[model samples]
Target: MNYLVCVLLIGVGATAVMDLWAIARKRLFGIPSLDYGLVGRWFAYLARGRFRHDAIATTPPIRGERLIGWTLHYLIGIAFATILLGIWGLTWVRHPTIWPALIVGIGTVAAPFLVMQPGMGAGIAASRTPRPAVARLQSLITHGIFGLGLYAAGWMTSFFYTP
Candidate 1:
């Protein structure tokens, strides 16, 4: 398979899996998923040179913020997928191991904890949330799921192209 096509397939497939998990969690546990619209708003402001917000929800909504946020979310997933491939090489994609995918998936929490959370005024790892520990745990779990998605997507891709 083409390198770029493989990346898109794995990244998008993994992100879709994570989204499905979020939907399931919301229905099963009543835990709300992060609003990608807010992420979009943050990015909008980010483009205009704003980095931090007292509370992103309170911030003004930008046009097409929802779409922008969702796109960014998937793009970030793709970037992480790229990172996995970069570290492990295309050979790993053919084999589809769980460890590297999980490592990258779990490690992705850093982006939200350090950058997204802080920039959006949730504090590091959601420290400012009403239930910081719970929020942290949720983030960890979600990212872990993303890792599993990565592995699953890798396996699915492997089925399509040999070598």
Candidate 2:
């Protein structure tokens, strides 16, 4: 139960980090991205009394499109904890630490900065951008948010799922 809770909390935290990432990206770099329409797309599909998600997100996903992005987002959190348990076994997972969450939360920013950004045409680490500094700043801000999210999610997990 605690493990499940941690996974969920981590997932939310990751989402927050991504949200902040978009803001940071826009503020730091003159780069363009999608709008709030993504929320609608995410929820709208669910609102139809179905578990189905939109085939095409309003704000098209960077890699593997919408389905892949959404699945990856949540799965990463679940998998992170799962992998931790797989390696350390249940004993380590029992204690639950913030550092692990923080590391995964913040570390994922590289996806957007180095991988996703470039794939999305933003350039490698913002190298092809007119404002590389701003691009780096955006990645930094997003990663910071992810770190905060990890801590927040860990606290939440401890509160709701911890013994």
Candidate 3:
């Protein structure tokens, strides 16, 4: 149905925008946002019904790892859609506001900078990465993209329920 297509399109568009932004950061500041090779591997593993986090970061991630990471990222976006649906139902689905997206996006940043980054040996906020400032910038940008995805998903749901 058209609604389904819209959901896919918006979710994918937001994610793609985020990814392209990452690539731009790499070229401009000399650091990769994610491992595209890894993303491809994730699809392959999905057929096998298994995904691995691999815990690799010193170098470019392998195909499988990036795939797993990206897959998880997408699924997370889908979850945000679930939240919108639960609260607002069909009506909320049709026209998701920017506030929810922005709040969720910004709110999600806490763990990575405070816990994950340091735990990963990145000092703080991924400061150990090739470009810390750039990494932080990418995080903010990517989270914003995720928020945009929430809005898209909600809008798509509206098309389906007509409320």
Q: Give all candidates' CA lDDT scores.
A: 0.94, 0.55, 0.58
Summarize candidate 1's per-residue lDDT along 28-59 as a digit string, tens digits: 99998999999999999998999999999999
How far off is model 1, as Cα RMSD?
A: 0.7
Model 1 quality (TM-score): 0.98
Q: Which regions of candidate 2 fall more than 4 Å away from where they truly are?
A: 17-98
Determine which window of 10 residues in candidate 1 has minimal summed lDDT.
154-163
TM-score, candidate number 2: 0.56
Better of 1 and 3 by TM-score: 1
Ranking of all predicted structures according to lDDT, beginning with the best and ending with the worst: 1, 3, 2
Candidates in order, TM-scores: namely 0.98, 0.56, 0.59
Residue 62's lDDT within candidate 3 is 43
Query: Model 3, 41-150: lDDT tens per residue?
Result: 44455556643333324333344665566776666555554444445444444566778656765666775677545644565677777789977977777777667756
Model 1: how far is 84 from its true place, Å?
0.6
What tens digits encode model 2's per-residue C-alpha lDDT throughout 125-155? 7676678887687666666666566556555
lDDT for 125 in candidate 1 is 85
